[model samples]
Each structure stands twice: as C-alpha cells, then as structure tokens.
Target chain A: MKAFPAIAIASGKGGTGKTTVAIHLAALLAAQGRAVQYLDCDVEEPNGHLFLKPKMERSESVGIPVPVVDAAQCTSCGKCAEVCEFNAIAMLKKPLVFPELCHGCGACALVCPVGAIRETSRAIGVVETGRTGTIGFAQGRLNVGEPMAPPLIRAVKARRNPDAIALFDSPPGTSCPVVATVRDADLVVLVTEPTPFGLHDLALAVDTFRPMGKPMGVVVNRADDDRRVQDYCQAENLPVLAELPDDRRVAETYARGELVFDRLPEWRDRFDALWSRIEECL
Target chain B: MKVVITSSNKTLADPIDMHFGRAKFFILADTETGKAVVHDNAQNLHAAQGAGIQSAETVAKLGAEVVITGSVGPKAYKALQAAGIKIALLEAVCPGTEALRRFKDKELPVLDKPNSEGHWV
Candidate 1:
C-alpha cells in the first residue's frame, strides 16, 4: 500500500499557530477515514495534548549515551578530555564525566587508551504514545533543564506510523530540532502570521531550509488585510496554501483547549481545504 | 604561590576581563619570584558549552595554585576547588597588575562559592 505523505507543520517563530495547523490537519485527515498518526516533535514544551487530549497509555524514557569511566583501568592521561569537542569530559586528577554536557558522540570512549570508558544511558526525557479517538498520537517531553532537545525529538519521531499519514508538529525556529523533525518529511507546511515581523522570520525560515530543497508551502494564520506575506510568497514562488481568518471566536475556542474544526463548524471546511492544498503539494 | 588572573590582552596594563570563560588571555604569575607568563585563551571563547570547565583545566595545567578573577561559574569553581586551587573573587575593573597589587594587600574577597551561574558569556 502507498503510504500517505508525511507533512511537517513548522514556524520560524513561537506562537505562530504551527501546532494549531498540525492538529487541525491531523483531525481532517482522520475525518476522511484515512489512518493518521500525529507526532509532536516539540519535545521541549509540547502543547498539542491539550487540544487532542490523547490518553497516553504507553511511555518510554529517552536518553543519550554518556561515558562511564572505570577508575581501576584508567590513568590520568587526559586523552578523553582532548578528543571531546563539546567539553563534556575533563581531567580533574582523574578523567571526569559530566552527563549534562555530553552529546553522546562516543568520541571519549573511542579514544580511551585503556578502554576504561563505557557507554551508559543518561535519561533526558520521555516519549508517550496514545490515541485521540482514532488518531494515533505521540509526543516527547524533555525533562526540565535538559540542555538538548534534538535527541528526544528524534525519539518522538521514531514512533511515526508508516502505514498511516504522519503529521509532525515541529518546534519553533529553524534550528537543529526543527531540522530533525522535517528532515524526512515529504511536505513541510510553514504556518506563519501576516505582519512584517512574520515576513522577516518567514524569510529566515525560507533561507535556512530552502537549501534542503524540500517542497514547502505557507499557510497564513490569523490573516487579516495584510498583503505582505501573500506578496512575499508569490515573489519566492512559494504556494500560498491557505489563509486562516483572524477570528476572535477561534481564539476563544483555542483558549478553552478546543479544536477549531470541532467548535467552529465553518472552520471544518477551511481545514478540509487545507488538506486539499497539502495533497496538491504532495 | 602561583596566581592566574583573567586578562583582556597580553599586557599587564590592560583591564582584567570580567568574564572568566570568554576571557581573551590569562596571566600566570609567581608571587615569590615576581615572574609571569601570558597564555592565549581564544579556543574557549567560542566554545558552545563547558568553557568555564576547560578554562579551569588550563589554569590547573599551568600549575597555578590560586585564581583571581572578576567572577567564575559553578563548573569552573568546582573544577578549581577539586584541584586544590585557591580562588579570590574580585569585582574591580582594573588592570592585572592592580588586581595583583590588591591580592598582595589581601583586599579582594577569597571565594568559597561560585559567584555566577554556568554558561557565563
């Protein structure tokens, strides 16, 4: 069976309605009797569960490999410290390993002359899997004060169901976590506002990921009479997928942890139209 | 006693850098012999993380028994303390020579705790 396209909903700035677009898209796809799995890759602070209210039944702790030094077999040669690019290891009398600073590159263990260093799992976050009605849902929650998010993001994305359509709710900004989310996606839907600030960040998002050469389109959220975003998308040859109206009622429904397509019956047609545009992009 | 002071440049007249991790240079001085050496620290300035720890390692490897700086983060403070190095905390916006002068006069406060948080830019 041909798998449905994996769509990643992303934004250059936070609170740009990336999750708002993603959950809505997932809901629309499921409404069409198609299998849908929503992967919330914003591990640092995932909020989609608020709307979907998925009953997470299974959870697994996620971690990266940090070095465990064997003192008996070790010397104070400081070879591990020399090879570490992240400064995760240090030579304090004997070699010291700081788990928080470690990136799990395994270079320290590789360079150990005595083979004293071994890899051990250092738990950084947790990934939970569940369902919101028929829609499969998974989200990564980075432990408070966790220095990195990409590892946990990868873990969350690993739960993507290939048999169903995958919708990735990416973290804000065009950084590593965002890249990790949209890297394997068949389509990336950039949800943006219509003001000048939105245009500036949209340009940044375009510049950062356009080189990746993924098929991308824009959905103007909270769109009013602003023509800046539409004009910029046209000039860049980027498809303007849809324009979500700046409706106060939509915000009121959102504040109560509700879905736009559910509360605002008229909005269902808009989301359905969005899925049509997404299929066109694919 | 050997003392390491974070500095902006190689010269003793230059003001001591307020930031320990991103400091441009380190002046290692022998209190008894009145001799000192300048060590370049351009590598740790752009380091993404653990700059303070690596800087502390440099200070330790230089055989400096005492560290006098504007402030140090928790990692640097712990690293230096682990190596049995005495740390004196000073907030003076002065030259390395002046800092040393105050150190000799016992005017600067010796640190028993880290004054700043980690990732100190």
Candidate 2:
C-alpha cells in the first residue's frame, strides 16, 4: 500500500485554532479531488466533527493489557513489586494494584517466578470512523478515567488509509499525548493565535517538535491581537503559512459547528496555497 | 518470617523484598534478618487504567509475606487484605525503610489503617 502523506496540526494551547486549520485543510484537499483521511487524535475532547459534521460509521474499542492475579498458582513472593517502576503495586502488608497507574508493561508477569501474575486486556477508549463532507474521518475517545491518551491515538492512526492524505487534529500540548500523535508525521503545522498565551505555548511547541527534525510551519489564526506573532516568526525564520484575519463570520460559523472555508470559499484558496508550500517544503 | 520492600537495590536488600509490577515499586523486608528484596509493579507495562488489578497480581506473583509502601488507595487496600497480603502504610518513606530495618532487628510496626486515597503525590 502507498503510504499516505501524514500531516499533523498541533498547538501547545487548547484554543489556538489547530482544529479549525485541520478541518479547512481536509476540506480543501478533498475539494482538490484528493482522498483525505481526517483523524481527530484528541481523545479527551474531540470537537472536529462539530465543524465537519461527518456521518457516523463504525466504532471500535481500544484496549491494553492489565494484570490479573492467579491465587491458586501463587507463592506470594512479591517479585512483581520489585520490577515495577511506577510504584503501582502495594505489596507490604497486603498485595494490591491500582489500575489507574498501571502502564501495561508485562514485566510483572515476567518477573513473577511463581507465575501468579498474568496480563488481561482492558478497554481504555473507542475509535469512531465516518465521513465528514468529502473527508473520511476517524476519532478516538478515551474512556472516562483513563489517564493515558497516546494508545488510543496510535489506534486511530493505525486505521488510516495509506492512499489518502492523513491530516491529524492533535491534542493540545507538547505533552505525551501530543508527541504520540505527531511523531510519525511528514509535516507539522502549528496553529496559534496572536496573543501572549498563544505565543508562550507556541514556544514550547516549537521546542518539542524541533527535535524531531521534521519540516514545520506556523498558521496564525485570528491574527488581530498583535503583530508579535509575525515578528517572532520572522526572527525565528519560521514560515507563516497563512494569517487568518479576526473575522466575525468565521467566529459565527465556528459557533454554528461549520467550517469557515466551506462558507467563506476564499479560505479554501488560501489552504490550497498552504498545501502547495507544504509540498515544496517536504 | 518475611517482609517486603519496593527497592531493587540488592546491596540494601536486607529486610526488604523487591517486587516489581506495572504501576509502582515496593519493598518487602524481614525485621529480624534485615534481608530485603525489592518489588516493582511499575514494570508490568500494563496501561495505567488497570493499575489496581495489576498491583494485586504482582504481590501474589512475588509470594510476598508482608508488604510495605508509601501509600495505597481503598480499592487496592481492600483487595490486598482479601488476598491475605498484609499491608502497612508508613507515613514517611524513611519510617518504612527504618521499620524494615527494625523488622530485620526483630522489631516490626503493627499494620495500621490503610490510607484510602494513597500517598500524597
């Protein structure tokens, strides 16, 4: 299968317009007759479909290994406690495990000389697939109380179509979840606003993604706050792909769960140019 | 006859039982001999979502006679008790290690009420 050119739209801040840019890019690519697979890797709070309104299709559960104790074949040696790095096991007076902190490493089962520990599968999230206008979409939703989101994000990416251009709507942050989503991307578009908070987080995002050595650019959303965004980009030699004006129409369209590119039409043209620039960079 | 510690340092294995799991590290030590073995559940590599279940099995697998740790939650504490794995919540890590040393010296602290929420992070 031909590998899809994966692009991840990420931001350090939560509301820096990553999703908005991702939605528009998907729409623009689809309009250009490109088969685009839009993936929402923000398992914690997926709002991409709100703008695209894709039809629902299949949903599948994503799970990871959890330990199961076997009392009958147990020696109570407590070797499993020594190997675990997270301190998830309480073994002094009585043996117990806290499920929330487990990382599913399987070392406990391996270290258990008595074979009292075994791994069991537990569901942690769900992935939903469907269509959002011309784009095929997939989103991972972490099960309530699940601390990790990377595994689910990986599951969503694993389902991507190789022939399609996979545009990832990544979670907000340079944390573990964000790294997991964009680690394999060919290019990363960092979407940010022209505000103090936006710049601060963008700086962090820059640090996180810079180490990957992948080609990256910035898209300033609602750039009416100040010229600092452009200034910083200029000083840092980061290309400013597009500057979305602070327009009321875009805000209204966002509130109504619609993509501005579809209604404004002009934004689509801008995205086309941005895509071309990305291709040139790659 | 046995006590547990989460430390993997064999040099300090006296009075400590080293056990590893997917979630956390623990130690089980003997008060009389000061012989300790480290136990780590953090090694289990299971998702953090099922830490409780993974921790329980880790203790059972190690065959730990007594377990000691910085803290523990209610669900795991209860399950450990039901499994006949004795638990001790030392308010301080030093005290837990000291208690293990004392246990090696034939002195042991009586197990007290397990903290419901766990050790303060």
Q: Candidate 1: deviation at residue A59, Å?
A: 1.7
Per-residue lDDT tens digits for candidate 1, residues A169-264, read 999998999999989988889989998778899888888779998889999999999899999999999999999999999899899999986877
C-alpha-based local distance difference test score of model 1? 0.89
Clashing pairs in 1: none
Runs in model 1 deviating more than 4 A are B105-108
Native-to-model Cα distance after best TM-score fit, residue A132 in candidate 2, in Å: 2.8
Candidate 2, B62-108: lDDT as tens digits: 67666665455555556566667776544444434565655555454
Docking class of 2: incorrect
Q: What is the C-alpha lDDT of each candidate?
A: 0.89, 0.75
Clashing pairs counted in every model: 0, 125
TM-score of chain A of each: 0.98, 0.94
lDDT for position B59 in model 1:
89
Candidate 1, residue B112: CA error in Å?
Answer: 1.7
